[model samples]
Target: MLQYFTLPVTAFQQNCSLVWCDETLLAAVIDPGGDLPAILAQAERRQLKLEQIWLTHAHIDHAGGAGELARTRALPIVGPHPGDQFWIDGLPQQSAMFGFPPAEAFTPTRWLDDGDTVQIGNETLSVRHCPGHTPGHVVFHAPQIERAFVGDVLFAGSIGRTDFPQGNHQQLIDSITQRLWPMGDGTVFIPGHGPESSFGRERKSNPYVGGT
Candidate 1:
């Protein structure tokens, strides 16, 4: 079975998830923004062997610590699609702008696309290329666990802000309706900066995309 723990990191309170397969104890950190010490401590407490760094997008708050973590731990970084290459490249600028610790840009070992799959020990998660939040934003869906790690795409009552560079409001709306809606109403999603919410509940009450 796949198990996960969410830890809010950085001043932005980005949700960095530590996911692992209970059977193999092999773990992956999703969106490791800042606060490396805390993330490492949690993984140590769980006795999980960190193997991979998975990214949803390359925003500073979501990927600030990824490069450092991967370099130090010898872990491979993955996902966020190829479109976010520029964002990854701009890590230094973003860090300065956001008043975060100096961030390093990194090259992903694998750039995921829609319909791709990532493995954590024995568990498999499907990847959905959900843009709008960032051109290369993605969502990791674990059907077996009925959970989706959705970056700044959707929240309990709001959606991602499409005012950043290359951000398109229409594209974001389309991504939510087309890419997320099919995940089933019962699917629980972990957003980038807020509490988790179910698709069913969001659909019924989220003003941004509700009643659609």
Candidate 2:
């Protein structure tokens, strides 16, 4: 079984998840948004060396602590470009604007392009570029594991806010319809915030998707 650990961080209270294969000690961090200490502690407890830090999007809350964690583990950070490199360069400002603490930012090692695959443990996570929240948002899908780390895309009963620097309402809708919905109805989604929900559940309940 793949062990999962969650650490809620920063004023945004973003959820940083550490997913590891118990047998192989291979690990991946999803949205190392903040709380570098907590995330490192969880990794050390399991004796797992973080191989890669994956960003679902370029939002400050999701990518803020990425630099610290990657520096600590000497791991690589990978994610989509989001076309908001300026926002990435201005993370500290966004944090202060939102009453969040100062943040350190860094560019990704590789952009999360659609059809990209990241290998972990004995399987692979198919990268689906599901933008809307940001121009380069992505969802990591591990088919055999029946799991996906959906950045800030689709939440439990809601969806990502499109008022940010790179956010868009119509694009987000298109992302859900064209990029995410095809992941199969039973796929389990571990969102960047809030609780876990299945693709099936969100399809049936998420107002934005279920409504219009």
Candidate 3:
């Protein structure tokens, strides 16, 4: 069984998720954004062996603690596509501008593309390059579980802000309507900084991408 725990961290309150395969206890930390101590504490408490670090995007709040955790655990860092390389490179500036603690930039062990699959124990998650909020943004989908880590792309009642540099409002909408909507409405998604919600619910009521 694949299980996960969400830890809200950082001044931005980003959602950092610890996901593991219950059978083997092999784990990966998704979006460590900060609050490394808390995430490490919980993973230790649960006795999960941290293996890899997965990212959804390269935003400061989404990847702030990635370098620290990767170095601490000697784990591979993966995903967020190659498109966000600029954002990753600008981590220090972003941190300074946002008054965040210093953040380090590191290259991913693997830069993911659409249709790639990553594994945690026996569980396989499909990757989709869903941009707009960030050009290199991606979503992780576990088909067997009908769940996705959507990052800053689509929110419960709203959508990710396209006002940021390189943010494309139309692309964000297309990613939601074309790429995500096909996942079936029952699919539950974890956004970057808020409560969990179902695609079905969002498609029906979300003011940004819901309804015809």
Superposed Cα deviation of residue 58, candidate 3 (Å): 0.7
Which ranking of candidates, highest lDDT first? Answer: 1, 3, 2
Worst lDDT 10-window in candidate 2 = 80-89
- Candidate 3: worst 10 consecutive residues by lDDT? 203-212
The lDDT, on a scale of 0 to 1, for candidate 2 is 0.81
Evaluation by lDDT, superior candidate among 1 and 2: 1
Worst 10 residues of 1 by lDDT: 193-202
Query: What lDDT does model 1 reach?
Result: 0.95
Per-residue lDDT over 155-176 for candidate 3, one digit per residue giving the tens place of the 0 to 100 score: 8898999999999999999999
Off by over 4 Å in 1: none
Task: Evaluate all candidate structures by whole-model CA lDDT and list the values in order.
Answer: 0.95, 0.81, 0.92
Query: Tens digits of per-residue lDDT for model 1 on 1-212?
Result: 99999999999999999999999999999999999999999999999999999999999999999999999999999988999999999999999998999999999999999999999999999999989979999999998989999999999899999999999999999999999989999999999988999999998999999987
Order of models, best TM-score first: 1, 3, 2
How many backbone overlaps does candidate 3 show? 0
Clashes of each: 0, 2, 0
**Pairs that collide, model 3:** none
Judging by lDDT against the true structure, name the best candidate. Answer: 1
Model 1 TM: 0.99
On TM-score, the leading prediction is 1
